[model samples]
Target: MILALAIPAILIKEPWGPLVLALGMLLVASFLVWTLLRRQSRGFPQPYEASGLLEVVLATSREWLWTIGPDGRFTFSGPISRELIGYDPSELLGQHYSRVMECEDLAEAIRNRAKREKPDSSWSGLVTACRHRDGRRILVEVSGRPILDGQGQVRGFEGTTRALDVPSAHDVASEETRAGVEAMLISRTLLTAFQPIRALNNGNVIGAEALTRFLSADDRGISPEAWFVGAASVGLGVELEMLALEAALSAAASLPEDLYVAVNLSPKACLDDRVPALLQGSSIPLERIVLELTEHHEVTDYGPLGKALAQLRREGLRIAIDDAGAGFSSMRHIVELRPDLIKLDRKVITGINADAGLRALGAAMVAFAADIGASLVAEGIETEAELDAVRQLSMNAGQGYLLGRPTVAREEWKLWSVPVHLKRPASGPTTGQHKRP
Candidate 1:
């Protein structure tokens, strides 16, 4: 009525405003019709005006909005659920949130919920699998926060889930990789190869590094590193690493008791609670085990890792920083971790016999290791000249093609039970003749 009264007054003041007046009236009429339809559809009481608006917004959104009670049962599921997962909101109410989650994603969702239990805690962009009403799985990106009561305790959770449209090629490859890794884990088919780490001075085997090998027909052409990278891409990196660790530790049981078995592990895997349990349960004694930190991945924060390593060390297990001098991160790891051993990377050991800079770096590492009371091991000693160079530097131990190749044969492993003298090259120049760059 107010608009009706003001329209004539404006038209009388400006006679040429009929088109403007008609357009304003049409807009007002359309808005009234929309408001009326919304009110009738929602049937909300006038007192719930704001809630009515929220309902309209949620009904139109593509993302599914959800709320669950403290007990994890669905309290409310938006109308979008019907379009998103083929389940009507009414069908989802009172069901557990797990009802819509894929089996593999349930544990991850539970972990995220635990985080939300803390005050003001929220999580976003957690991509997980959701189950559809017809047994199909949908990939979704989820974001949520805990709902708090007046007393600041978590009352429930509210969240939004949007379906992800991954490119078909990438999605197919990821699914294949995930399935492959899962099969490998289930069948326990990973093979352990032991590469001897020898004493450079006496040419006697002191320890063997456990290397994981995938021997399944499907995995024949894929390198171990590629397999691990594929597993990581599909959110199964930790699972695969743990499986490899278990396999390596299990194989270590057959090796000589006097020899320490060095097992490679990523920092993230070390932080897993299962690691300590795995180590404790191993038949091999703690003192006979060495945990080598693979340098391919960077350690974001060393405090927790340091604490974890400290706990393991106190249990009599030694730690080695693998691939030291490969990069600045590796150097940082040595300074921060203060490992019992520092293994020189293949990059640093290759051609050290002739490169003055490489020799100087090797000499500096030898000095550094002695100063820190850590044993130095040269890796990838493929040629006799490389072996001569590392031996000349007085490296405590070395492992390479010249020493011994990684072998899965039990007979070859038994050969290390006795002292074996490794022949040194007679032609290489001695360390005394090498000039400092």
Candidate 2:
């Protein structure tokens, strides 16, 4: 579900063999997953032995495998199950897959899934339960490939599952979790909150970034990761994303003409035609709405991404690369795509004041953006010192705690509208307090 935005690394210009294509997809997807798991551990075990029963079904057969049951139980498992659960395939059986899961989470998810709702999950990866060998329940990553029975009617589900190895839902009963989860389950119930992105020098509210808040009955807040993961689990990720997009566009319609609204695009939804079409109808100028490529996803195909962006650019829509330094392709990608805005990630800003190498890198990035005729926006500008350093970097703009905090239902969005250098106009040009959102 977290990977709902993940795009396959390879693109298909023209198809030759369906079987070959499927195999290719499997290998690429499996490798990506394996990397995520193994890179964190010394050496993870494979799902099942090549000669094991699960091996025959998962390896020889194309049907995806899962060691889970409908009640979110991993009472049984297959070889591939080990790949997902981080346990021996034989260890899991009769374990309440939801045992390790937060109770409230299981209930809510089950309720949603059983509703058989059509979610915006066009790009959501499937999830399943796989029993761990040690009789422990683990959440497994899986791909749902229907296991057809002799009758050809739907009987049971079969998919690959991977354990995130995450501990119990962080405070599932907490009000925040409840609110976030409920909003995601019922997309429209959530309000798309907007916070202004101001220019440090002039205090002008140049843009607004939409943030989500749930109007849940319980009033608990949900994390973006949890919301996305739950939505992906029930196959609603794309729909949720689109719903957010709609809300964002609607919210932006009330802002100034020059104020661009930046909306996040899930990896899977990147190439979706609906995105361009929706923007085309927006009341604001298309060029003013920045479609940020979130670091949460990887752009598997630079060619397609480039081509897609080129078409958008042709339509006068500008682009911005979010979390600039967080990916293997961040800086390289900025050059490749040549976006209008390059957002410097917070990682580089964390200790730049104390680290010369980091400061130089940050300075270089600002210079690179200038050289490419793109504006550089530094994120995480929390400290007065950071603001001074960033200002010295001479980047086009910056945003962080040092400037202001993100406010959604502010009494007056204009309160923090001052441009950089004028943020604390009454305070003798001293900077304002900056805090992380």
Number of the predicted model whose lDDT against the real structure is largest: 1
Q: Which stretches of candidate 2 lie over 4 Å from their true place?
A: 1-187, 218-221, 414-437
lDDT of 2 at 364: 89
What is the Cα-based TM-score of model 2?
A: 0.55
Which window of 10 residues has the lowest lDDT sum in candidate 2?
428-437
Off by over 4 Å in 1: 1-170, 423-437
Candidate 2, residues 10-109: lDDT per residue as tens digits? 3333464455556667777887898887765555444344447644666654332454444334535566544544545454453333322332233333
Say which candidate scores most in TM-score: 1
Q: Candidate 2 — what's its lDDT?
A: 0.57
Candidate 2: deviation at residue 431, Å?
Answer: 14
Tell me the number of clashing residue pairs for each predicted model.
0, 41
